[model samples]
Target: MAKVRSMFREVLLKQGQLSVEDVTTMVMCKPKLLPLKSLTLAKLENMQQAAQDTVRQQEMAEKENGK
Candidate 1:
């Protein structure tokens, strides 16, 4: 279980999708939340793409607002 958790955490960290602190906090608070065994690389890629899209939208909005 620990190995699976670490593997998940490391992949997310390497992808730059989540910070180490964020992953650590979530894992510590909700140990059973992530179904690491069923997590696939494709799902991870989709999540990362979604996150990047969100950030891009936010940046564009901010630029429009002259912030």
Candidate 2:
């Protein structure tokens, strides 16, 4: 269980989305909330949405700065 959690943390770090603190807090609070496969899929979807939000925010910031 420890090894699996460590590996999951590493993967989340490499993806560059959630911070280590965020992952740690989540794991501590809701360790078994989702099944393994569902958790993996949810993480991927979350990462995608985060990236999209980041892009949108950057565009908005650029427009504001230009004005």
TM-scores of the candidates are 0.41, 0.43
Candidate 2 C-alpha error for residue 51, in Å:
0.8
Q: lDDT for model 2, on a 0 to 1 scale? A: 0.75
**Model 2 worst lDDT run, 10 consecutive residues:** 3-12
Q: 1-67 in candidate 2: lDDT tens per residue?
A: 3534453443435555664353444334645564557877889999999999999999999999999
Clashing pairs in 2: none
- Candidate 1, residues 1-67: lDDT per residue as tens digits? 3534453443424454653353444334644576545558778888999999999999999999995
Model 1 ranges with Cα > 4 A deviation: 1-39
Q: Pick the candidate with the highest TM-score.
A: 2
